[model samples]
Target: MQIIVRAYEQSCAGVLVDEVTVEADVSKTGQQSTFSVALNTPDEDGDGYVAILGNGKGGTDCNDNKNQRGALMSPGNLEVCDTIDNNCNQQIDEGLDKKWYLDEDGDGVPRGPDFISRCSKPEGNYMEYPDGQQFDCRDTGADAAKMFPGNSEVCDGIDNDCNAVVDDGFPTLGETCNAECGGVRVCAADGLSVVCSQEPGRYYHPDRDGDGQGASGSLPTLKCGTEPADPGTVSNDDDCDDADPATCEGLAEVCDAIDNNCDGVVDNATPACGGTLKNVASHYVNLGGDDWKTVSVAANGSVWVAGHDGKLALRRPGAQKFESFSHYNSAPQAPTDGSPVLNNNNCGDHDWNVSWVNANGVVFLGGQTGWIGIHTGAANFTCVPGQMPTSQDAITGMIGFETGGVTTIYVGDTSGRLTRWRPSAPFAEQFTVVNNSDFAYYGLHALSPDFVLAVGNSVTGSVQKFVSYDIDSQNPVTPPTEHVANPNNISGNVRSVWMGSATSACAVGDNAAVWRWDGGTGWSKVVGPTGVTGRFSGVVMRNDTQTQLIGQCYIVGGDGTSRAKVHRLTPYGWAKPLDIQSATANVALNDLAITPTGEIWIAGEDGRVFHYPEP
Candidate 1:
């Protein structure tokens, strides 16, 4: 109820100082029940409020005692948070109390203001918070238990603490670090650093070669799901050569001196390109009258040469001179190169007529009387021993292949005998009949063991004969296919033949005899320059394992008496190299071979060995 106390503010204790009339709530309990507004002049309770008694219109003091010492319960004091009404209001602690909602999650935090008003905690006396501390961010559902003050920051896509920030502690989270992978910097598991999930399946690496694999030890830099978000990344890491696209995992190793298949082996499948270029024009001249008839090259750059009647020579790798191994030479001569030639008189030197060196640096030799042997840098030659047919002439030519300890060789002779010889086989299976009266083979070669090409003139040197034998045939009497034509036949006998590939070959002979064979057709006769005539006995094609000699065909031979030269048998015709013609003015070069190191060794008459060093 409103109270109108007719008193002045300065003298409300006993006597009125000035005339005034005020109205306030004076209907408090024990508010001067029998006193009137005038009789309320007694300063009971000693508070500034006068009890509104009797009529209760002017009773303002809620408590007044006989001793007049009332202090807390009166209209003159401010309301406080006690059970008693301090301001003489009927309600207890009315204006100064608070309304507390329930912290149902019991995180010591409340949600909204829908609560019970009380001076103390109403239901549960949880810890008290200061003003403005009751608005919990998440005080209801499953997350309400943690939506309290000072909550630990976590990574559940929400703010657990009441800090006004979601997922706190990760200060830079949701920020763009490696934005290309994604737009958010995720909180790492350890909470020590941030992470971008799109980067590196920790498997998506850089594929610099565009191969399906990346370089070894490559860093992961892409996210992989469908096609990689980064186009240069791959799911694998098996690329040994990051710069070469063809040098990835599962590739067939090529002859490029690299681990093309990523198998930790470099060029293990194909042989590497070899041959040191001899840009300088100089040859060694040592033996006086030794003639070299055959030239064979090995992978280690060794040059093997043989001739009629046990003539043999060898130019070891890095040697500048040929070692004449023939016992026919009157005396062994010293070489001009600083390196010495070790004369290994293998098997006491018989009539070694032909030579062939496989890729493994194994040398096979053919000799007169149908003798065959092998020299593998051993102390002695391993000769296949057995008495052959008395009609077996000299071993004119031979070509062989080796796999492990096994060897397959085709040995040809001037007696028109082509025999199939294998390791430990004394008597070989003869592939051709003994036609000593008709056919005499000279040079022999094979692209593979399946096909063998033997070129020669007739028994009387009247006509050229080109024959290819199929060694794959089970019949030892397999018929020889003659690459022959009747009308425009090549006149000069084909002395030697070299096949560049199964499809291309060149046969060289005396009197400017030259013929090129195309697999599509038969051999075609070729003529040389008219005035400068020479016997072209050796033919070789260049192969670097990358490009094919740029279409260059080198034919080495010379006029029988003098005028040694190197002639180029081009697609058009033959052209003589005058510089080589002048280098060996009188000597006649007989055979030439290109070693694995790309060195071109030319064996000539008089033990004169000219070299075109690997370029």
Candidate 2:
């Protein structure tokens, strides 16, 4: 028996196996049998190889023999076609001399003959192999040289080494680090790199300085040792005392120093007593050699003091102190002249009275200087334009008119004659004698421009009286037409009378007599409290509600102690008098003036001005 087989050749030698016959037909030329096996014809272009099988020697013409066959005819044709399985071993053409076609368009269809090229080629390329197998040309195929390294043709996201993932071993381009943790890979054909940022542990670092950069570690280093001190903070060594930062240089010490903690003062460092007292006289001069007796604050706030040492003192709100000189000696010779009287005894006696022209700022002073003086000063004191009287009459009381700018000075002599001096010119001429009378006008005050009230006694009867003079027309030269007697009964001489602007007045005199006049009413006696009586030496009308009567009273066995008796005027009558305490038992309150600001300045015989802030 014989069988036909195909043998693969290494090269294009085109050798074939011989056809052999079996011994079943051993008799030679027995039936003249013959057998033949055909070989395929080669192509004309010499582009193909073929396989053939033939018997080496023929024994009979095997066409007539029934049971004898020359060679078992092969099932497959011996033609060298491009179809796979040329040897027919189930896998066609898989051993050697195989060819593959690349579907460059990736359509999966190959350009080949006698085959269904419509299916996708596994390798998509026309690749040739020597194993006579047509492979898909993938990495696992026989002709897989065109595949990537490691024989892998799968698409991966990354080029593991960053070479770009054109033909890499991964299924897609290998994943890359997307600068984030545990990122995944994406398809390269999708024009994106694989994000393989699956770092085990990573964290973000904030740029504290806001420099648009991040730090590599968990905790970033600070750029400076400490933050700069804030505008007024105590850090960065800027403040001397960080604990007490407010204590710094050049700050106010208040009442502490050493900076108080550094503020730059010693102790009690701030300036002290830097402000001046308003309306207070800064310095005081000894008026009348510190023997100032009676000081009166005029209605316009000017101050005048009279002394027993024959001096008249003057002071104003801003004066350094009280200044004194004899009114007679300091009298100016002319309206424009100024003089300072240094002599203490220029006036012959200590008695004097002073009053102010409230509307005109004129000051009138009359005393035992043997003359009356009027003074005016634009800045400092200047004597008014007035000549001295030739007579030696002692002027006891003086007062300026409340209206009409009239000033009347009353001069009293031991002979019971009283004379009046009136301003005759524009304060530039000396005053002239206006009227003379036989009544002893010791204490006088002009209640108004038209009325004159004088207090004194008659020489014949020694009867104390209050006389009112009516000028009729302010004609100082004409004799007064109206006269009135003191309405109250009194047995002693009247020493003084103080007329309050509100029509209340007090008249005081010897034998502890005190009389009060309210408006146009008759005078009434002012009774004192128990154990307070002797004589009322001075009387000044305070306000409508009260009166201050200062005098000396017998304390023990006629010792003659000084006293300040205050009496309140009630609706019904005068209330009981109250005594003011004295530092010493016998201190006298000689005179009193209620200042414009309501302070009571009391003059005492001890040459002191006691100031009561408000009384």
Worst 10 residues of 1 by lDDT: 275-284
lDDT per model vs. reference: 0.62, 0.43
Every model: Cα RMSD to truth: 16.1, 27.9
What is the TM-score of each predicted model, taking all chains together? Answer: 0.49, 0.42
lDDT score for residue 183 of model 2: 44
What is the clash count of model 1?
Answer: 22
Q: Which candidate has the highest lDDT of all?
A: 1
lDDT of 2 by residue, 1-615 (tens): 444534332233434423333334545655756665553332222222222223433211112122332121112323233443333334433433434455443323333332322223344354432333332323333333333323333344322222335545443433454433334565455333333434332333343222223322224222222333222222122223322322334434432112322422332332442221112221232222344445567666676666554555555554435544444434433221132334332334445544443434455555554545555433355553222453466555566543344444544443344445556545433344445655565566555645666677666677776656565444455453333434544676776677765366667666656666665635666664345556555555544211222121111111143254433332223333333334431444455555544444545554445443211
